[model samples]
Target: MTRPSNMREWSARARAAGEAQAEPTGATLIRGARVLDPASATDRKLDVLIENEHIAAVGEALAAPARASIIDAHGLWLMPGLVDLCARLREPGATHKASFASEMPAAFAGGITQVLIPPDTQPALDTPAMLIRVQRLARQAGTLDVRMLGALTRELSGAALAELSALKSAGAVGVSNAAAPINDSRIARRALEYAKGLELPVHVFAQDAGLAGNGCAHEGPVATRLGLSAVPVAAEVAALRFWISLVEDTGARVHFCRLSTARGAELIEAALGRGLPVSADVAAHQLHLCDTDVDGFNAQCHVQPPLRTRDDRDALRAAVASGVIGAICSDHQPHEADAKINPFPLTEPGISALETLLPLTLQLVHDGLLSPLQAAERLSRGPAAIAGLDSGRIASGALADLVLVDAEARWTLRPERMLSAGRNTPFAGRTLRGRVRATWRAGRAVFRASG
Candidate 1:
């Protein structure tokens, strides 16, 4: 397979030339905003000139040139569009529940320009043909740039490995099975070895299925008080330990998806310290809520590998702050109302996050837990690196996929106003800061706030 040459530098040069010639008529100048590019490690107030979908310049007082579209960006923050590592757009067979067309608008509204889709779709994305079909569908849907993670095992049964080489060739960014934990160590080892040989990253939803049982909530006081089945923390910890061992043995790139327990973070940290090629992410919901939030037995809080204790939440946040956790994903699993309106045990797990991910993450910035750059790292560059995409940067010549945000802007999350088909979000009516004003993909304005 041929690797695409880096075109970011060339993209910048083209933008500059276009702006120089067009500025005499008029240029679109985004003035006086704080620009943060995590990849470049740049954080400062700068004026950005965008001409024909490329960044013409990123410095102080660049003239708008003639006839340019002027975007007043005072009190705004401009950064690369976020790249979400773990998002579930239930398309193909489950379009009635959620579709790429619906999820794209929500993703763009939340400042996510690119997303790595899970392998849990209908028919399961276990083959190269399936991966290509999804990519084509996403392009036709015109929401956000969507890449697929091929299934690690055929049918996601965890009994037999899929064709990793064929899947990668078909444009699968990585391989995963969503929350389908691999129970057979031998099968898991074979998958890892194949991934290593292909140099493709393997995304593992680390959790011991047997230990998790029929648990509906975190194994803690809340579950005991509510008389709910509990999913022990050991479930996640044990699975992560086994995954780390496999990663070390095969030297395969492994990504632990949405780690929800404190012990999970500790194990990941220890593996990283031991120089194992491992990386992990935490869901935005898990980072913000604890098992205590499940007091009412709300199914919205009923996520798989259920939310953990307060100590676990704090530890997860610290892991993110300390750089042990590299990315923050929406894990944006969307379900219909019927799927979630039932009792906790019978209802499906997960929530809609495409519209809520950015705001909730910015809450971290508001509370002084992370610098804007750090937030950008987790929201953009980190995920891009994991997916091996040439995005998540503001360097000249990079793909002009970017987002303009008003970090100080505050608003209430109203599910009724969302563009997503699924309205099962737990953050409905919650107030949040930071809103995306405009989003560009491949040098085109795919989304802009209607005012």
Candidate 2:
């Protein structure tokens, strides 16, 4: 089904044109900026020219066209816009928590231009009609490029396999049962085989439901001290081991989502050693914050597959640094405030991430855990590769999806100032370095830092 182009009411074409007029004109030259092109493996000072939503040139001193805007990017780092592999922009069902309209702006504010939303929603994106509906809603929102993931099982129930071919035909980039794991290995193997035949990547949330068993926090000293039921590392490890065995048996491409345990990383590392076509992502929160953050009965830190020990967090950071982890996603699950107002265990799991992904990632750089180029790779190139999207690069003929950041700028997290409807972030009031100064998607400036 063709989406209605007129439904996009939030376009910034007119406003962007006005802003363009106020700036110097000449092929939108981004001057004196350090360019980081992970795809091209070029990290140096260069001027990039954008024309008609495509990168025209990149060099030390590129000439701009007579009628184009010139942006001064001195002391700024210019790189490809981030491609978030996992994010939940609740539109069809839970708009009160988040919508494409709200999430897109938040994504832009954090330097993201493309996002792959999971299938966990009201009607669920398991059918062609539902996938088309998501596409239409994304078009109407019109801020960032959105791709949908088809649910791996019907209604994400893990009982029956979804129509993989039909969902892919309807524009699902991949298939997943987000936030819910397939408890039965037989069922999981069947789903993997079906996805293998379709040559579609299957995204698995590696957690054994039986092991997780109504747990609300990570199983550790923190959970014990807080008097909360815990989700053990075995839940994640056992599921990963089963999935890895299935991958070897079926030759299916698998992408693990939000790997939170040290054992999870070890399993992935061993799989890579054996040459399996598998990749995994670590959420920014999991990489930085740990289960200890859940102290004092603060439900905001609650998460699915729950946060783990400091050692686990360190292991994830090391995995990213060692190249075992391919991508770093926001896993941007937004929940309404009231949903989180209850006591610890009953509160919803997830935290608002679209707005904080970039700043939090920059914190990794500040701590010397990740180089600037590695951070760019995890945030952009890697995620783009996982979704088969033609983005996350700065090259001739590449789409003009770019972000310019002031690496030294500092700011504090403010939930009320966020664009996402959900105000359930744990980063609230935390000061951080680095800031997204401007974001351009398809030659359009979707966001600019406030003065």
Candidate 3:
């Protein structure tokens, strides 16, 4: 499909794709579930009724509608299905590691109904054609809502501005360079100005190429002892300062992705305090792990914005608690086993985190850092506002996208038992509390775990 000139046309194409996400099926009633909707600050017992593709009603016990399939939700927590801001579904060319068939269920099992993918896929999503292809492929997956982030530079090469207007018209929610670097600050300023004109938010990775050169681990005592090339915290802090200046000057909205440093989070908090039209999200894994996790050259812990000190992790947790970090995402990048089988420095950096996003976020609650309501806001509502998606809520007339969670259920993470095709997860074999009992999208059950 060619790039349209306006959003109406783009929206029409989106409607076409959404047609496959659900049929106008019969009604369903979830009874006696403790409903938690962070958007409305709602937390109470409610019986939710679903008809067709939207929530028909939500209140105390309403008589079940005729022909509705009734679910016994006693002791279950019914909340809006998660909206993950950063999840890499390896489609369009990286099927050697993952595919829509594998990752979709992984997302559903984790209670994720929507995902925002970056532009760093194989071949990169730099054109309207590429956007349309992923949209079509997601429709075929039939279990997830996918939004694309357009490449800030053509092919994410950090050279020239891409077709930003064309990308917006083709349904890109925002633009980013992904994990790739913007080597030139002049180019970064131009990007913010250009996206501002179109009102598109620029997603910043916030790491300077010069400060982060060829490093495999965080510059800390741990890396020094391990004899690994070290990446200093200044790499993230300097890049964030430059981008905040651009946002302040250009009046552009910028969302920092996977911020991994304490001082960088302080900079972002200051930017927000000054009302600079800036926001930020942290990956869930960063809040729990630190440079210490890489002590033995464990490749599974290798990630962009290499995990820093325990103090940094504590500060990040506090930031999220104090509302400095607006969202928590899974910086999920899946790789084949061979990709991580080599020597530590040579191994690709990432974690197959689709199945662990929600559980990890809930961990903050278990640790007394974030309340359950705060977790819902960070995981669902916060990312929704950042991406400008009309989702991440449960109310009358809203889309019937929801998750049934057994918040007290205990489970173990076994890569071999995971639905994701890639078994490259650092959380493997760890036990965790809370599990998704079922996931529904547009009034139809996408995934329901067997008892």
Best candidate, lDDT-wise? 3
lDDT of 3 at 195: 98
What are the per-residue Cα lDDT tens digits for candidate 3 across 413-443?
Answer: 9887776666788888899888999888877
TM-score of each: 0.92, 0.94, 0.94
- Write candidate 2's Cα lDDT for 186-296 as tens digits: 888999999999989999889888899999998878888888998999999988998999999999999998899899999999999999999999989898788878998
User: Which stretches of model 3 miss by more than 4 angstroms?
Assistant: 1-24
Give lDDT per model, in order: 0.82, 0.85, 0.86
**Better structure of 2 and 3 per lDDT:** 3
User: Where is the poorest 10-residue window by lDDT in model 3?
Assistant: 1-10
Worst 10 residues of 2 by lDDT: 1-10
Candidates 1 and 2, the one with greater lDDT: 2
